[model samples]
Target: MAMAALTAATTTATAAHVHGLCSSSSGFNGRKLSVALPRVCAPATSKRKRAGGVAVAKYGEKSIYFDLEDISNTTGAWDLYGSDTPSPYNPLQSKFFETFAKPFTKRGLLLKFLLLAGGGGLVYAGSNATGDILPIVRGPQQPPVLGPREKL
Candidate 1:
C-alpha cells in the first residue's frame, strides 16, 4: 500500500515537472515546493524488472520501486542468523512473558528489588536536588504594629 502511494506520488510529481507546473524554486500558484523524489543510484539492468514492465531503480540489492505483491511474499525478517531455523529469542512469540520471567522466578530477587528501589530513589533525589536550584517566590512583608507596652 505504501509503495503504491509512493509510486503514484512520484509519477504525479514527474508529470507535473514535465509540464512545468512544479519546480524546486516554485510549485503550483508560485508556492515553494519540497517534494522528495527518489534518486537512482545505479544504471538500469534487464534483470531488475517490475511486474508492471517498469524497470526499477536499484541501490545494491534493494529495489527503489514499490510493488504490492512483494510485501506478501516475504516474512520481512532480516537474515541475521543465516539459518533455516528461526531464532530462539523471539519477543513477539506467545511465550515471551514466560521466557522473560523465568530468570526472575528462581534467583536475583534481592538485586532486582534493590535496582528498582534505587531507580525510584534516584528519581526522588533528582527532584529534591533541582528544588534548591529553582527560584522561590516571596510576598511583601507587613509592617509590625506597636502594642501598649511594646517599644521598638
Candidate 2:
C-alpha cells in the first residue's frame, strides 16, 4: 500500500497556460491604431492526468485546442478551475486515490496501515474526550452554547 501511494504521488502530470490578447480600433486616425502583446500563455492549472486534469483552450471560432501535459510537479493533489476561485483541496479523497495509483512494497503497506490506524484512533479518542468534557448534544430547543449559562 505504501509503495502504491508513493508511486502514485510521483506520477507524471499535466499543466496548461491560459491567456488572451486584445485588439482595438482608433478614431480620427492620427498616430492611432491598436497595440497588444503577443499572446502569452498564462499561469496554468496543473495536475496528474490520471486525476482527470485536462487543458482546453479556444482560439478562433472554429479552432479549439485541447490536450494534457506531463505535470508531476504537483504533489498531494490538485483540481482544475475555470474561474477566479480555484477548487478546494480534498485530502481525504486524494489519499485514497494515491494509494492505488502507485505500487507498494510490503513494508510500505505495513507503515501506511499503521499510520492510518494510529491517526484514526487518536482522532476518535480525542473526539470522545471532547464529548465527555462537554456533553452538549445540540438540538432545535437546546440552543447550543459554550460553558454553563442560564437562558437570558
Top TM-score prediction, candidate number: 1
Candidate 2 structure quality by residue, lDDT tens digits, 14-49: 111122211122323433233232466867657535
Instruction: Please count the clashing residue pairs in each candidate, in the order shown.
Output: 0, 9
lDDT of each: 0.67, 0.52
Candidate 1, clashing residue pairs?
A: none
Candidate 2, residue 13: CA error in Å?
33
Give the Cα-based TM-score of candidate 2 against the true structure. Answer: 0.20
Cα-based TM-score, every candidate? 0.21, 0.20
